[model samples]
Target chain A: MTAARAQEPVIVVDGVSKFYGDVLGVSDVSLRLGRGVTGLVGPNGSGKTTLMNLLAGLIRPDEGRITVLGLSPDQPERLMRRLGYCTQVDAFPAGSTGRGFVVHWLVASGVAPRQARRLADRAIARVGLLDDADRRIAGYSKGMRQRIKLAQAIAHEPDVLILDEPLGGLDPLARAEVIGVFRDLAADGCTLLVSSHILHEVDLVADTVVLMNEGYVVAEGSVRSVRAELTTHPLQVLVRCSHAGRVASQLVARDDVVELRMHADRGGFVVSSRDADRLHLDLERIMLEQGATVETIVPADEDIQAIYDYLVSGAGGS
Target chain B: MSDGRGPLLPAPSLRLRLAQAAAIARLELRHVLLSRRAASVSLLAALPLVPWVLAAIYGTPGRASLGEDLVGFSHFVDGAVLRLFLLLGCMLAFAGLVRREIENRTLHYAFLIPVRREVTMAGRWAASAAAVATIFSSSTVLALALACLPHGRPAVTAHFLHGPGLAQAAGFVAVIVLATATWGAVFLALGLLARRPVGWGLLVFVLELLRPMLPLALKRLTISWWLTGFLPLRSQVKAVVGIPAPPPSPLAAAIVLGAVLAVAALVVAWRVRRLELAYSGG
Candidate 1:
């Protein structure tokens, strides 16, 4: 496929710092983006939502500059029209049918009356809520309510979409469907910024990742690049054999095996080394030389979850 | 090229601002029109006027002095209905305008939109004004129609559009509209600025009620003081009450009310422009 359009930055933040009284909301955060999907990942209270609000023009940073679609968050009118923000707090006006509510929202956004209705229908259909479009919002389930919120956000076809915890309350099936919608929207070239504590979801949907912790952007880049920045620890080895005691002694004697734990179930012996491949080779030779039956050899750091934990907690670096 | 002046243009126009305002208004209307709470409030508002109608029908028509007294009673009843309905309408409408959004957590939903905060505030005030008028008008008409029976006074229907009464009632309606709109605006700012608005709104109500009893010019500082000054009954009771009289001209009173509204609107806009959602230690 031809390269997707590379326009000027639709959003830019420079040295943006926010504080609530004395507590830092997010400090000295800077980012520039034009399009495509970017995942904002962090534990709760890590300021992912705050940064989303800042981008949506819902809130202003006290100490820095932010421009969304070349409009200041402080001046929400011009910017709001060009962006669609699906807030974590999903709500609809009481007593209104999903169809009526969505259409009215588009009308309020300055869509022509007739066009508003059409667009509302189209958006509801897009979110797979076409069958239930005419039902009162009060009668809808939580997952359906979230879809209505999504429908309103996209009804006007805003240039940018900011979704904060969009998948928080969905069931597994609903999550898969919503994730498909997000991926499709991103693939269509909408500048999508999603914040979720669910790491696997972010890894699946985002090409770029911004990791925050304690009101700071600790890491931001391509997912692979940022994960690689983690301090690589020695690989772990677990061995279960007839001569386990002898294997443990041999592993500890090696300079690379820094930490060792021996299980009492006779299941195996666990050992950590700086070079996992080297340890694998050494263990192979030792097992052959000692004639010990080996059961399992696994590198503990091979999973993304482990990499995420290591990056977030500064486990090795700090 | 043209005397060093650029083409004369309306500065950026209020198109976007107006659009934002309309969206907010539409949201409020959708909320009030569709919600059960609004229906319940409408029922509660009409409930008080029911007793008056029953009293007018079944109470003592055979007494000698009853005819004259009934005539006088009719006028008094109409005026009281107008006054009471407007006052209650304002209190109830503004209370809901500020309180319900917070309770539902829907106010934060609006903030997520790219609309200007001030536009949202003002639009809510506008929508609430429209909704309150619809509720109060129905009550006033019902009360007036009941009051017009037996006296052959042609009822309260035609009277609404007549000579001095029309201008006076219009003025009354205008004051009610402005007072409630201003009240909603101020409370909306409080709602957006603070985590809790109902507590603050009630405190403001108490402050306004005690304003006239204060020792200084602080009476002018209260919204109720200006609102009551515009009440036709205040002019009637001025001599006997011995209250510190407001300026003599009704026009001056109107201007002061207008000023209060303008200032409150500006404050709401300013507060909304700077609003920062700061729940998580930010």
Candidate 2:
């Protein structure tokens, strides 16, 4: 999926903006998403679901153009075959069984009933819901309902899968099961765009992250690559030394160490700086000269949470 | 693949699309059958039986055979049932066909189907009409039979199956079917056009009740005018409701009703083609 994602863009949104009368939905959004699981990470009302809805053809953008798989969403009869969208809204027609919900979507999408039944069984099994597949959806637990929604979305084996909050309401066991299914789909070179508010959920599987805040993409790229490019944001680092206050005082005068705070136990220091290499060299010199025992030095901003905080706060949001 | 073109799935033929629509309708009909509103419709359809039951139990009791009462009551069911309760039942049956799904946020199941939106609407329309006709027609048959119950079993059996009573029962059944078809189409369109179609349904209901008092030109606009035309003219109804001109022939009345139904279908198709799955405001 990583090799394929670099080839070409499958979905193109060119300067698209949507508005609901006096309220702004999403404004001046553009993206060229390719293959693999590109996670859309944002806070509530940050336009994550709105962008997903736009690409899924649930609502039309008031401005600009959107093309999914080279076809406009306005032509759903054609585009829907290549794309499947699993919404966050957990709803099904009343009195429908789990198998019936999955099979109904397949048969209504022009698959023969015989094949639909087989695919429904395959999908239910893929989600590890084979045992409860025959139970009515009304009787399903929250995790089971989430699996059924995933089953229906993937039953037809579409090329582009857009899931909004796909991991929500899942227990640890079911979450592991569905994550394995997503990995398998990606292994087959399928394109997936998943959205979730759980940052760790995105960090677990997504190689590329689209960080959004207040209706705009603040940053998008591989998590590590995005972190590397945040040169302006002070990189938070932890220094575990015997004399944390003395080390912090000696290193605080350097140009690279913008701010420093002694650890609560006085055994370490937490420093914020714009440079990594120079800060590490200065810390080593201070520790060696002052006879301080340096246990460990860790760059805390090398992970997804740091990248997310930098970009979201960089977009003028806390 | 490098040119950004995704694999285009094979398009389904028209024949396959129709089959898909039938499958969707079959799935949707089961839930609709158990909806709270469908129960309300059934209760309303059977409401027409009430006044007649009281009349048979308490009105002018004598040596008069209830077979005579059944025959008389069966004759009046077409005008009364079609004019009042069946229309309301059919309206309830179809008003929630698509609108309720949108409100409940389950409409997305239909939106992503690999067929035109109109096919789905047509399939649901077919199912709703079938259910409404079946429910209301059974109510009419049962109410008419109640009228024949006072007579002995021989008289009741003879009147219903072996004589003109069968013909009368069939006549009322046909009127119920037509009313469901006409008003079902009307209410389904209103469901698509307005957020609160029941509010609009009140206006249509008022127009239907006032049909007899309006001029002939204004009367023709109401579905009840064409529906009542299918009945054999009753002098009592005509004297009170003032049927100034003779009703159209059964064939002419059907043709007019069919035309109205066609327009409703057209509006449904046109509206569905542009339909986006945006839920209404809270």
Candidate 3:
């Protein structure tokens, strides 16, 4: 799937903006996605799914244009033939067997009958549900249901697979297995846009990250770049102890400890520093010398949650 | 494959859309047959007619009589049963369609397909209509066959015993089916257009039933006007009722019903096209 073909940007969403009456889904969000996996990450309402929908040709953008594989989404004919969308919402007809459902999608994707069968089996097996393929979808667990959706999306070998929260409700093991499939898809140069609130999930699979908040693109760049922008200040390490002054006094000597705030409880103090190594060394040495036992060290270097909170609360203007 | 030219069939792919719709319809049919609720409702639908059928067979003034009075009497009974059957069938079908989709949220799978939303809708409509048609046709056949049995009333069998009479009876069945199909489309469209199609259908049904009494051209506002116009039998009899009227030409009424159904189906298509897979708050 990868080696024989030249890389091409299959999806181009330029200045795409959409307002659902009053609520905004995506605002002035623009990105050119080519082969490989791109993770769409943001807080719950951060327009990640909106951006994906825009690119998938599910929703028309009010202000900007979107092209999927060089076709407008509004023009359903040309665009949908090549696109496969897995919605964030996990739903399937209750009565269909997994194999029946997968076969239906395979046939629907325009695969030849023989090819459809082969593809359906391959996709079902790809999702690691071959044994359960004949089981009724109604009887399948949520994890199994998710895999069924995945099988449908991949059965046709779509050029671009746009998934919204595909990993939701899966156990850790299932999540890993699904993530592995996503990684394989990316490695095969199949363009994939995965929208998830889990930062580590995205961090594991995507080279690029698009961050949205309140229907606007707060940030869009390489994962490293976004991580760097999020890492403006050093992690704040709050150490709890009986002698707060003693801990603060030892921390003040090191240049690495840039900011210090005494804990309100007087039992500990919070120290901010970019260098984790120096902070840990300083804390260890100071606690040993003072014979003060450190209760806890909490490093808050704009954890994904903090970044998400900032994006959400600060989502004033798109 | 043409250079910069749009393909006749668009995204997600037509093949997938058809497959998805077929799968949905198949699942819906299975649900209709296997569901306990569906079974009970279907049983209830057929329940009320049993006593009326028994009465028509045994309660006539004389057991062996064969004459015009029996024909008139049979027409009255048959007409009432036919109307009741269609009305209940339409209501049940419409409510069933809306409730199932709303409860299960299974519509999400269909929404993912690239075909026009109407295509998916048409598939479901066809599926339901096929089921309903089968049920009604078999029931009518059974009713006709039973009417000919030895224990059946002589007047009932003697009236419809001949070939031409049987053909006319078949024609009557055909007219009833055509009318029901048009109403089915209307109801199915209503189901797609509203969240509570049955409630809305009832409200509209009551309004249509009463609207005919209003002055002049307003009578045309009711679907029943067109539907009744197509019936083989007239609602009122001149001797029994005060003012009797001739039945309208079935051809003209069918044309009108067909056109209205087409327009309603188009509206359904348009509504489905705009539909989102959101569970609620659309």
In the predicted model 1, the residue pairs found to clash are A19-B282, A20-B282, A234-A273
What candidate 3 keeps of the native contacts, as a fraction, is 0.19
Report the number of the highest-lDDT candidate.
2
DockQ of 3: 0.14
Q: On residues A203-298, what C-alpha lDDT tens digit does candidate 3 reach at each position?
A: 678877676766767766675455446555466777887677987987888777788888677888778886766778878877888888767777
Residue pairs clashing in model 2 are none
lDDT tens digits by residue: candidate 3, B62-128: 4543333334534533344444555567667755565476577666565556556676676667666
Worst 10 residues of 2 chain B by lDDT: B232-241
lDDT of 2 by residue, A24-126 (tens): 7788988988778898987777888888888878788899899987888877788788788888888888888999898888877777778889989998999
Q: Is candidate 1 or candidate 3 better by lDDT?
A: 1
| Model 2 vs. true fold: TM | 0.85
Q: What lDDT is reached at residue A190 by model 3?
A: 66
TM-score of each: 0.75, 0.85, 0.76
The first chain of model 3 has a TM-score of 0.75
Categorize the docking of model 3: incorrect
